[model samples]
Target chain A: MLSMQKVSFRYGKNTDYVLSGVDADFVPGKFYTVFGPSGSGKTTCLSLLGGLDTPTAGEVLLDGISLRQIGGEELRRKHVSYIFQNYMLFPYMSAVQNVVTAIEISGKGGREAKQEAEKVLLSLGIEEKDMYRKVRKLSGGQQQRVAIARSVATGSRYILADEPTGNLDKKNAQMIIDIFLRLVREQEKCLVVVTHSQQVRDASDIRYELTDGQLSLWGEAAEYAEF
Target chain B: MRNFSTIAKRAFRTISGKWKGYALLLLVVAAITLTLYIFFFWLDASARLATQARTSTEACILLQSNDRQQIGSLPQAMREHPAVKGSDTTTLLTASPVNFVNAVSRQDSPFDLPGESDQVLVSAHTDIAMSDAFRTGNASLVEGAFPTGSDPQVVIEDVLAKRNGLQIGDSISMSLSLPGYTEPHQLNLRVCGIYHLQQPIEATYYTSDGTPVYGASPYSSVFVPFDTLAVRFPDALSQDSVCFYLTDFTAISSVLEQFRQLNPDPARYTLSDFTDYRYEQLLQASQAVGRLILAAVWIFIGMELLILFFAILSILRSYYKDAGILIALGERRRCVAAQFLFQILVVGVVAVSVTLVGAFLLTPLLATLASGQIVHTAAETLPGNAVEIGAIENMARLLEEHGGNFAMLYASIAVLSVLVLLGLSSFFLFSHTPTRRLFDKE
Candidate 1:
């Protein structure tokens, strides 16, 4: 479980906070989404949860271990994986090679890593022809699928995605939503996604709204009381 | 842990993708290396030539033999010594060449002596002295012949003979003036030959009267056989100096050392050889030229390094995004550094190999240009008959023997500079570009 305990953040020496007094908990077999408009610190929250940044105040804990103590690079490499909206694949590499490289970085064996990379790419609706083509030559939907494959290939328990389907069309976004739901429900993985799309927010198991550096649970007392 | 295979694969692909940049870098490095090689060859050749020129010249050794032990046997000793080519002996006196010429003409106070100096009178007694005289075109027997021995006969240079108007068979009287002697001792001799010389053998010294005088050339002096002079002034004819010419010029120092061991007292016996001194002078001149070449070589190398530094920096700057991506993917900083280093090492090794071939072809052209200068400078100080070409060729052979060091240094510099570039590139990655900014762009 990754949790944010009374977490607050500010950029540099500014007086106003980008995120303040925020509390959140993420667990396996559960899908979490933070939805808000621009300037709502939605991506900032994902950045902290992904271990790409540290909160200026309060602590972010991973399985009762501090994210600050584990170090961002180590935590990201071993426990959490991030996916960006733009799909930051290496332009020079093919879709399969991109997946393979990510898995290798996550410490998989060479032969097994390549096998897993191909398996994930094929499952994500990437054809054999497109799987071997350079990422730059791949279409937007195919590139986003490759990025999803890369995130899943790492096998990290927590996936912190900042608007994973922001650049995808309806059908591709729906497919990505299915993949995320299956990962959370079947694979028993915790996924924290930040998005403004209602379909994605409704597909998630729990929802929170962030506005002006403040976070609030959105469901009614009985409907969300189990949390 | 880094997956080295991935880094290597990526490095190769990156190089292939940017082949033009790597090619340009290789050419620049090869050109710089070629320049260094040319200078090394030229400087080495010039230095060897200068050393040979100075050491191969004629050497003169001065020695004092108060007792006739060493002096009497000097001619034979010099002739038998393996290093000696030729030798001659001379004696100085306070007697008069003018008085002798005046006596031969049967006239007193008729004209001023033409070849006379107000210095101590000096004459040499050697049969082979004519070898130097005739070979130099300085003198030849114009009338009659050279004396067979110290047979009471004299050969006078043409200038002295002309002023006195003396015939070849005319008898002359020479007198020696000693400070404590009751009367002047004299010897009567007949003139055997009269030779003309453009430049003559001259010696300078002070007379018993303490009058300083500069000596005149041998063309203005008298010469005779040693036995007759010894008979006439037995007490005055001690051999004070002997000069030896060596067959091998390089053996001069060792022979001089042997002479020192023979005569150890510095005050009573003074010795000097010009070979070592001349060698030092030539070495200093050559070293000055070599220093200039070294300076130019280093300046070019420094310029090449600056170009390399900026070129690598530019490449790294363009690859910042890639490096940041790698960092975000959980690649260690050292892994990123190694990836960059591998690429640089590949380029550097290829460039150095190309330079080796280029330098091999270019060295001969540079050496030929320098050999002409080597010969010309040698001719300036060496005798006219000396073989300047042979000395230069010998220097070339010597360079061939010692050429490996420069080639090694060339390779070493290429490798070391590449390592430095890699280190700087790694530092640039760690300190100049940040991974957080890479993800923020999305």
Candidate 2:
């Protein structure tokens, strides 16, 4: 679970604000959806939640511990798995290789890491036939699936998906939504899906929309929302 | 702790990935290496030549003058001085017009007086005083046997033998003239044996002037017993002039002072030392080659650094998005720098390994190209013969025998430079490029 209070950020002190006065909370064992217009700071929110940036003002807490207080990259590799909007799969790698990247990044040993990558892809219902194919040859939906598998493979408690279904077709999007809902409910991992897609909003258990720099819960009080 | 294989594997991966880099690096390295080889090989050979020149039994002192009456007193004085390891006195008689039958040009020039060899060599003990005439492997009798038991047998230098249509047991004519005489007086002597010398001095020979002459020559050395030479023309040797030889080769100036006080003729006589010998000249020439090698090495290494830095920068730019993603994923600046650092090491190891293997493999072929023998010659000191293509092979062999010292020094320097390269690359990475390098971090 992650929580943020009055989180405001500007790229530089004198530059116009990129995010400002944002207060939000992300709960574990829940599928949380983040929706916003373009430049609405949803990406910034997700990055903050995953410990990618320092807010100009406000605090972000993960499992009651502030993400800002931890040592940077190692902590992220240890606790958070991120899926970028454009699906940042390791390009020279295969589908399984993409999944194994996170494991290697986390400094887990190799033989066991590959097995772990296989387990994640298998659980996502990606076929073994496509596992060895390089990521560039795979379809966008397949690439997104590989990214999701990598995020899951590391067994991190937090999953920050930046527009996970943004580039997918309706069928792939619905399938991905279903996978998130199942992982959040059963595995009890924090799944924060940042997207503006109405279908993702419609399927999520809770939704928060970022307007300007602030987030407001628009749901039926999926409230335990503010820590 | 990983030995050869692990390092080699890492090197192989980098080479396979960046074939052009490997090729460019090797091209420059090979050219530089060959240049260094020529240089270092010369140095090694010349260095060995120095030691051999120092260690060999050579003429330590030679005194030449035209006056036989005054120099005859040299034996008594020289024998009294300490540090007289050994001494050899020879009578070098000069004249003109040998008058050989079927001769190329009945040249009336030096070496017309064929002096007695034993009288010329009688100053020192035969065991120690005998000049190293030539390598014995090249000595064999084509007609009769070598001159034995002082039977008045004569041997001529190979050039003289080839010049005149003379055979063993054949007779030859010679002449000797004094200052008072306008024309040379002639005498005939029988030839007995022929020999060649390893020394590259001008091919010359000697003779019996009106007075016995003591010296060396090209096509000019003739041997006769001291008794035979004395019976024919007896005279004491001249020693009015003086050339100095100190106990140590380096003390020429101080020893020159001593020789001046002892013999007192500075104009005609001069101090001779190691530097004046054939050895030092070869060494200087080799060092000149080494300087060229050192310059080439510096240029090559500088080029390598420039190329490597630019190449790495381009690679980093190509992966700008990757850097952004890593930064967004919370990778610290240090980790990003380390990855690139590892990448360059991978390349360095591959390139260096290829060079080492290629150098070792091609070394023998290079050696073959440089096949000159280690023939020590007096002409190594003479002008027009300091270095030449004809003797490069011999020079190379001598260089090879002494190259281990140079190799150790060069390799150590190379390794140190590589380490410094690592530090410089890392410094460049850390100080010049930060992980927040690209503006598009999302």
Candidate 3:
């Protein structure tokens, strides 16, 4: 489980706080979504969750260890995988190579890592023939799948997706959402997706609304489902 | 991974992948390397010639004139000096047109001369035993042996011998005519020895044949016993023709000063610092041309490396985004930097290796080009015979004369060029911030 307790963060002096005194708990086998409009610090919250950035004045605990205690890079490397709105695949590498890079850098199996990466990509509907092509040549939907494949190959417990469907069409967005939910339920992984889509909101086991750096329960039914 | 070989290999791969970016730069570097190689060549050759120059240290002081009368009984003066140990004087006035043939039979003359002017060849004559010792004190021996014993013997110069095929055990006829005798006095003598003495005299003299040879060298004159010369042509010399051989060079000035007080002819007595008299045209000529070529090579190479740097910088900059993405994917910054570093090392190793190989392959051709089809008389100093302790002693003596060294020209150049190239490379390139340049591509 990951929890941020009364976490308050601001960009600079006298500037509006991006995450103002927010508290949240995330657990395995649960799907959570944060609903927010533009400038709602949605991506900012995802960065905090993945330990990409530090809280200005509060504690973000990974299984009772505060984010302050664990180095952000070590925390991200060992415990969380990030999926950006832009896919973030290495442009020059093929889909397989991109995923292989993550596994290699993470110090997992060597050549076996490539086999594992391909298996995951294949499961995510990456065409076997197309997997050898570079990411730049892949369509947006395919690239998004490739990014998801990398996160899965990392094998971390937590998947922190920022604006998971921010640039996708409704059909592709829905397909991505279905993939995240299935990963949480079938893989027994923790899922934290930041989205403004009502469909994503309704599909979450627990939901929170972040507005002006403050988080409030989305509705009592959503919290009840998590418990 | 801490695998330096892998890093090096990967770097080489990257370098190879982008050859066009630095090809011209590489070519320029190669040209410069060739220049450096030639510089080293000259440095080595010059060093060798300089060493050769060092060995031929000058022994005798130059008198103001070739006229021996002004020395004022130097032979008696030197024989009388307390500090003097051993001494000889050979006058190098004008070379005689002497021809030599090995004494095949007693009925035939050992010398052959048809068309030549009669001339006087005056030089230091130790007594037969002393003449043997004096001839031993020289660096080169072209043919024949040193003369010993007073059995009517003389050693012809080797150049004179070569014209008629003379070697050891040859005899030649030579005689000195006194001032009043118009008829040349001839002495049929055993060719006890022949000499190929080298020196720095300016007077040009030759044998019947036209091959160039050192003429009128102080040591190049014919050798005979001091007694024989006096007995044969007593009037040719006087109490005035005395020469001194001072053992301790430091006492030369005082000895000269004493000689001046006794004899009053300034033109008759002048000191010759033989070292100053001799010049190393080969080494000097090499340095002059070598410096120009080597400098051009260096400048050309430095410019090429700079061009390579820029090309490499631009290519790596274009890959900055890929680098950034890799960093974000948890690749260590060092690993990212290592890739680029590997590439540079690879190119450098290849470039230097290629140049070295090329230079070694072309060594003969270059050696020929560097030095035209020139004749080099390779020489060394060895004893005339096992009993000739004078030669062994002279070798050590001449070794000391040259300050105990053999190759000054190339040694100085090798050291200087290496120092300069290393200094230039370190000054221009090491510690340059490669990362900053890559990042600044933004």
Best by lDDT: 1
Q: In candidate 1, what are the lDDT values of residues A32-54, reduced to their tens digit?
A: 88888787788878778876678
Which is the winner by DockQ between candidate 1 and candidate 2? 2
lDDT of 3 by residue, B79-102 (tens): 455434353233221111111111
Q: Which segments of model 1 are wrong by more than 4 Å? A: A10-17, A35-41, A166-175, A196-203, A218-227, B1-6, B17-21, B35-303, B357-366, B369-387, B414-418, B421-433, B440-442
lDDT of 3 at A198: 82
Task: State the displacement of the C-alpha of residue A109, model 2, in Å, after optimal TM-score superposition.
Answer: 2.1
**Candidate 2: tens digits of C-alpha lDDT, residues B391-425:** 45545555455563464346434643653475356
Q: What is the lDDT, from 0 to 100, of the residue A153 in candidate 2?
A: 79
lDDT of each: 0.67, 0.56, 0.58
- lDDT, model 2, position B382: 45
Query: How do all the candidates rank in terms of lDDT, highest first?
Result: 1, 3, 2
Tens digits of per-residue lDDT, candidate 3, A43-147, equal 777767766567898988999998778765566556788776778776656788778777766667557878999999999989899899878898888899999
TM-score of chain A of 1: 0.94
Model 3, stretches more than 4 Å misplaced?
A10-17, A35-40, A67-69, A195-204, A215-227, B1-61, B64-109, B112-167, B170-173, B178-268, B271-312, B355-442
TM-score of each: 0.62, 0.65, 0.62
